[model samples]
Target: MVEADTTLAQVLRSNLMLTGTKIGCNEGQCGACSVLIDGKVVRSCAMKMRRIKDGATITTIEGIGTPEDLHPLQVAWIVHGGAQCGFCTPGFIVSAKGLLDSNPSPSREDVRNWFSRHRNACRCTGYKQLVDATLDAAKVLRGEMSIEQLQFMIPEDGRIWGTKYPRPSALAKVTGTCDYGADLGLQLPEDTLQLALVQAEVSHAHIKSIDTAEAGLMPGVYKILAHKDIKGKNRITGLITFPTNKGDGWDRPILCDEKVFQFGDAIEIHPGPPNVYFKQRVAKGEETEPLFAAAG
Candidate 1:
């Protein structure tokens, strides 16, 4: 059973108990959930668990390195103050690992671009420190530094734990022993249903009439929630102000009613074999539209 519309952050957090993968935005815009899928850094928030269920191997911060046998990147992160608030550290570490794994020796500009996709950060540290740390760690990983020399680089004050020049988790991270949120066994109930939002195609248009009769009759669709189906509150949580002047903002139901707020706004929730729904959407060319829009 593949899971669809399942955020990798949630999979890492709730299922695997890998609290390291922080859920910054719960949206793909933030790189907090960045992880390595087949050695490429990807945003976990936007990735559907079902899409990767077949054969893709995921690498989380934990998978990259560990405290006992840290990857060089982890060491760099600690010695260089690349981590602060520690929320975004895991994702950054994993991303850096992916970059270094491919490039081994990256320039400053390369480092910046490697992290270009990540917009979130901690107040304590800046990108320069992270870049410097990564460079140093790369030197160590590439066998440029001897263990004794690496140890000598440590400060006498011992302010940092892994600052002795080598990251404690570097080896573990590179070896793929560390585990993160998504690695845990989700083990959801057999009957537990998965859902995905089907949004409106038009932007800035009031919905005239919705034709759900055909969709509702589909084989595996459990329920089609409309604005009227909401019993409690319809507003989206975490919003400070209602911009649309639409009821409490929560007034928007789980599904759009007569008013469609924006293009790609959820109009329907599909529950069934995730692969089937995904295939159907792809077959209808909905999947390719976004790519074309982005390219244009």
Candidate 2:
């Protein structure tokens, strides 16, 4: 059952459970609650049920594309870094789609003006990326370029210090569609647990009785591996200081046996959750963030 005064945003999120349609600034100043009504984009939070016609058609973010088979604009959003947070992305995408549907060849100013005329305010990507993304999508729509060619990075003008021989993996990397080893591992069929490294804090440490009684019993922890669990000689080979240094691969161990090597050496990689601290700010004046070693 639908409420009398409930907005389209509410219906998409609360009723239909299309949580991609984000709600922000409920007064409609933010375009976070954007959706299409009869192919036109509008702020869903301000759109009341009473304002709709009898047979009106509506489309939300879910109607746009999926992760596997994304729309060109959706792909462009990732390439152009326009859709950072979901709050403004759905509305901005719908609004952009509406604009491109009507005007296939829009200038940068046209995109900027179109967004301004629609009140498509975004907090993450300022506005330049959005405009650039719209223009790129317009090119794709105008059949000037293919989706695969979007990955080709343009070099400088003539006599460039570069070669044109296409790298096999360049396209995927450029389009942000390449899945690394860890990504492939996460896509495994079975439920896979994550490994979070708890490194040694000090630069050096003396041998002492290690304790994991508390850490092992923490919530969501599956296993806490010690040195004994490692089968082979713990080492990171290929660190050849001299040509004669070719014997044992005992530089860094799979797990610390008696002493901690470095300050941040991963001593124990306990089972834990993954990748939440990756929100380093974007190009358009986003906040700076700390970098850390990647997970496997």
Candidate 3:
């Protein structure tokens, strides 16, 4: 059972343990959480459980294929270098599946038009590789090309460079089985308490005061640990050295108690110019500064 206010993406990830449906830009701007809803691609993040009709079918990346019996699109994605960084790969594949399902004989321009209309964006590898892979997958689906022909084989010369080899994690990524940071975090023990930082909102400001009383009363909030609750060194040991060979003392703090230098900053920088206390003097024979000449 899902909460009425919970998003479909949240339900899929938290309740159903379908981490393949990423929760990116939950406002529906990024298509990372895309899934097929009733045979049409829909942003899962923007869709709430309350809005879903009964018995409506949904298909995520996991439903598309498996590692052993991979879909043609997944195979093409690997061989054609369609996935890089891999975060956006699932969305692209799901969206592509929707397009291919609707129009299996789509032209190259049609593929481009489909992606543009769906707003399936990929940041790592350019769209050329993705389009190429989609077109090739379409051919395979049409029985014009065999999957074996598209599979990569090692060169006879034993040289792997400049050859098309699938990325080591490509299968996991394209299949939506790869565990990203957020995905791994979900596997932690139920007793694990999540930490959220109370970051500064302004670029620079003096912290007049902080009141955690109201927030502490909120249910499910275990504790609001302030800087004062810290046990040992409240700052990170500053190892940075100046040109004069002096170590910067306590410059990098673990928590800011007094002031903030920038937004989301936990450490406060010392006021004034950066660590270099003295101006560098260029040494020329006799044209150098009197201090440098005298030192020589």
Candidate 4:
């Protein structure tokens, strides 16, 4: 029960820890805080407790479904890619549920018309995927189709996952707006060090000597990490997941202190600018490469 002047959104989010009821543009302008009150969707942020009747039951995001047993709309959201960044997903789902309960057979235009009255805001995904998800979920609710039938109902040959449903990011990839790991460098702090790969030239070797006295003076190179710098056990441990190989996982190196081990085992790593410019800056590495054939 809420106080007389308290908005349902305030009590649900701040007090009850229901952060799914997002608070956005809090003047009933954006319906991100929409909740079901007596089976009708109302913007919880704008509707005060005084307006709600005493006996009216409220249904929140938690009421509809849980993480264990997700609502069909929630499932449809992921399968259909209705949620991107997912700030407005809860409100959209609650509103769609309310719409389906009242009219299960809503047409495409019916979906468009209903959303025109009940406001919701999504900055990331354009409303096309939202409409697709709602309509798809409506099909399930109306008993015309099953959720799994819509999702992974491939031929019984069992060779494929789905019938080539394009991912939601396909358009974004084509438009060149999709963010990649290297692209995120712009968002990182200016002082953050970027790691660039510097491969050891030797193919097979025991690392007898290393000369980095001049390489340390290179521009933009903050520091270098080698096997000597490691403070703990060199080999990674504790990942034996089977009964047969329970305690035998000491077969790798953090850094090859005396041996190169393989063709691509990581050797000396330096923290510097992630570019070819940093490559030219390092001093020449002169070392002995000893080759020995493995004997079974």
Candidate 5:
């Protein structure tokens, strides 16, 4: 049983613990939480528990296939390199399953139009592989291709390059059995503290004070950590690529303490002291001229 305000995505993920249905942009702008409701694809994040009709057949990514007895779509996804990072794979797979269930012989354009219409955004794999995978899955459903054909063979030299050997985790990813970061919450202790960021609203300003008394009074409010709460230097110290950074690597603050440098800056931290960490001089002249000079 779920509250009226609970979204279908929340019901599937939090209540039922069927985390295969992912939630990205929970406002429904992103189709990451897409699932099938009575064989029709719908963004689960947009669906509310109260709005669901009684006895309506809801199909999440888990219902489509399994690690054992994998679906054609999952196999094709592995072969076509359809998912990288795999956050958006389940949504696409569910959407594609819905399409193939209705129209088994959809063209590439049809697949493209369907994803475009549904706004199934993917940050990885460039999307071409998704269409390719879906098309091949359609062929398998239509009996034009065998599922075994998707398997890659190891060459005599054992060089897997240029071959389509699926990643060890690919099957889990496509089948929605893989555990992502958000899914880790299922295994976390009930008393574990969850963190939320409090960002700076203005681009630049001296932080007079952050009033957390009202928020601290709210129930279940464990602790409110500010810069003052940090015992050590509240900075991200590392010169990743900037060899000529003024503060070496101590410039970037973990939490902005005194002044806000930009909007959305984490509320604690500040820039480092004014001193050139590294300096190099390049002289342009004849063969006798110094090509390089350094000062630190």
Candidate 6:
């Protein structure tokens, strides 16, 4: 019954030791830590360990297939140049697995949409190769082509058209024996600490002041930190600023300075049990109310 709030990424890397799941951006925007949770793909970095405490099954790259028994998707990736550098391979493989699991015979458009919107592959391999690879893998999985036939399909010119050889992990991946980073149910001691960001209440407002007295005194609340508490470099890299229709300059803050330029900017850090902090934020209030309320 070990249960403490923890980051999914930390659990995967430290406890599961499945380093194949790369951590591109700690934020959920990047698909680097993408893994299937209960058969649905989710970004691990945004997922809190406490959210899945009921023992939901998780699947990471390791769970899909192995070098000896590669999944069809793996085989196609190699044959079609769907992978290069390989940092994003695990994510792509997992996503492709999800797509194939639901729709074993996906159309070209399906493959394009699945990869384009969900898995953010920045490698510039382009979708044409990926789509072709997925289709090829689907054919192989359906037993429409033999491994030997696939081998002869490869062109001698070294183009990403055809190749043969069973993906080493294909059998294991289809059998559901492979373990991905997300498959790990890393248990945390009951006393492990957790943290959540406390966003600002108003857009384009300065830090008039923060009243953490009541929150700090609340049960299970450990600490409340502001921008001043940031020890390391405060700015974010690779930032892009653009203009909005309102003619207002839309300059996003990689890390919020004292002034908040947007509505959902993170303003503070509330360290404690993850559940407790999240619940507090979800609670309805003037300053702490959610930006969007569900309709009845």
Q: In angstroms, how far off is 1's CA in candidate 1?
A: 3.9
Report RMSD for candidate 5. 16.6
Q: How many backbone overlaps does candidate 6 show?
A: 23
Across 1-296, the per-residue lDDT of candidate 5 in tens digits comes to: 55665578877886678898888787788788999999999999888777889999999989999888889999889888887888899999999999999999999999999998888999988899999999999998898988887655677899987788788889888888789888986667755655656788988888777787765654555667778787888777665737777666766677787778789989732222111101111122211112122211
Candidate 5 residue pairs that clash: 255-268, 255-269, 256-268, 256-269, 257-268, 257-269
Q: Write the per-residue lDDT of candidate 1 for residues 137-255, one digit (tens) a residue.
A: 78888899743443336476866665445345434333333444433323455345567677888886787887789878777778877666667666565356558665554545457
Model 5: residue 199 alpha-carbon error in angstroms: 1.6
Q: Write the per-residue lDDT of candidate 6 for residues 227-269, one digit (tens) a residue.
A: 5676765654323334433433333444476578777788777
Considering lDDT, where higher is better, how would the candidates rank from best to worst? 5, 3, 4, 2, 6, 1
Looking at candidate 5, the ten consecutive residues that score lowest on lDDT are 273-282
Q: Residue 272's C-alpha lDDT in candidate 1?
A: 67
User: Worst lDDT window (10 residues) for model 1?
Assistant: 287-296
Cα displacement (Å) at residue 165, model 6: 12
Q: RMSD to native for every prediction?
A: 10.3, 12.2, 17.7, 19.3, 16.6, 10.6
- Residues 254-289 of candidate 3 have per-residue lDDT tens digits of 777777867887532221121111111223231122
* Clash number by candidate, in order: 18, 2, 0, 0, 6, 23
After superposition, candidate 2 runs with Cα above 4 Å error: 152-296
Worst-scoring 10-residue span by lDDT in model 3? 271-280
Best by TM-score: 5
Stretches of model 6 off by over 4 angstroms after superposition: 1-4, 151-296
Best by lDDT: 5
lDDT of 2 by residue, 1-296 (tens): 45546677766664565666666677788776778899888899888777988799887767777656667776676667665543466677788888888888888888888888888898766788778778887888788989887643556554324643333442333222344443355355434566767788987776476788977766677788877777765665546445666655455666666777688876776775432212312233332232212211
lDDT tens per residue, model 4, 1-296: 44656677866664565666777776797777889999998999888767988799988777777655667777677666676666577788888889999999888888877776889777887888788888888888788889777663446775555454435653332222334443355456746777644455666688887777766887878788777888887775446445565456665567777777577777667787644243454333221111112211
| Model 3 score (lDDT) | 0.78
